[model samples]
Target: MEARPRVAGIVLAAGKSTRMGRPKQLLPFRGRTVLECVVDNALASRLHRVVVVLGHEAEAVMPLLGHRCVTTVVNPLYGEGQSSSLKAGLGAMTEETDAALFLLGDQPLVTADTINLLIAAFADFPSPIVIPTFEGHRGNPVLFSRETFPRIEALSGDRGARGLFREYGDDIRSIDVRTPAILFDLDTEEDYLRLLREFPAV
Candidate 1:
């Protein structure tokens, strides 16, 4: 019998958040910082492991994750871009990892259900890429098969996971989802306010 693939979750929390000013990872949402919420949610998922990459204000942001069940690593090259954080997170994963789910630290609303849903799909129909989409719009927390990690590591600049979708072409897969939370990320003051106004109950 084929052994089950070990999937890991990688949270990119190292951005400078130049648009939001200060560190959005430390911003509060639902009684917790955005990084804490995101990491907690990822930890609640069925992934084999969860790794959080931090930079910028890593000192302030990391302690928030101290209580959570996650492995936090600081990306010294975080100033370069999201790709660097992605690389840093992947490096922290174990050799047995079969795929990695790349998540945003600012997207606290992306629930564990969504992460597990993607993992389930990838388990049943393994692919080079598994992206969550709302209606026709693509969203964050893309799952990359271990085969693509090398390609992703080679990526440079601020561009993150999305660019590889176009590069891989036919290898990409999609899991059509119902929630817009997959698209929500705290990138600015207005974005944070919108998150408050949009999902007040959560």
Candidate 2:
């Protein structure tokens, strides 16, 4: 029998949230912090391991994850931008990890089912990148194959891995998902309110 790929889930929660004027990762959502919800989803998924990269208000956030089954890492260069946090998370991956599914801390609504869908696609297609699409629009957390790690590691500033899609267009696999949560990442107070209104219970 073929061995299953070891995929890790990396939650990027190191952003300073300058736009929201607060750490969105610590925001309350469904009885837990936004980051907690996102991390919980990742923990429930099929990924072999989970790593959460924290920065900005890491002191306050670290306490919340003390009991969870995740390896947390701090990104001192978080002020640099999303790329730094992305790199921080990637640095925690083990040698056997075949791919990484990058998730956003403020995107608490991205369910385990959505992440599992991406993993399933990678299992079959083994594409350079696996992205989720909602009604033809692409969204995160995107799956990056180990082959693209070097290019991703070379990234800098606030840029995420999306830029690589253009260069690897032929090797990208887009999976259509049923939920719009893939596109509803929280960025401001208005976004938070909207999320509460839509998912008051969970």
lDDT of 1: 0.88
Clashing pairs in 1: none
> Residue by residue across 125-175, what tens digits does model 1's lDDT show?
899999999998999889999999999889899988788888889888989
Task: Indicate the worst ten consecutive residues by lDDT in candidate 2.
Answer: 193-202
The TM-score leader among the candidates is 2
**Runs in model 2 with CA error above 4 Å?**
none
Q: After superposition, how far is residue 79 of candidate 1 from its true place, in Å?
A: 0.8
Each model's lDDT comes to 0.88, 0.92
Model 1 steric clash total: 0
Q: Taking the tens digit of each residue's C-alpha lDDT, what string does model 2 give over 1-202?
A: 7787888999999888988989999888889999999999999999999999999999999999999999999999999888888889899988899999999998999999999999999998799999999999999889999999899899999888998999998789999999999999888889989999989973
How much does candidate 1 score in TM-score? 0.96
Give the runs in model 1 whose Cα sits over 4 Å from its true position: 1-3
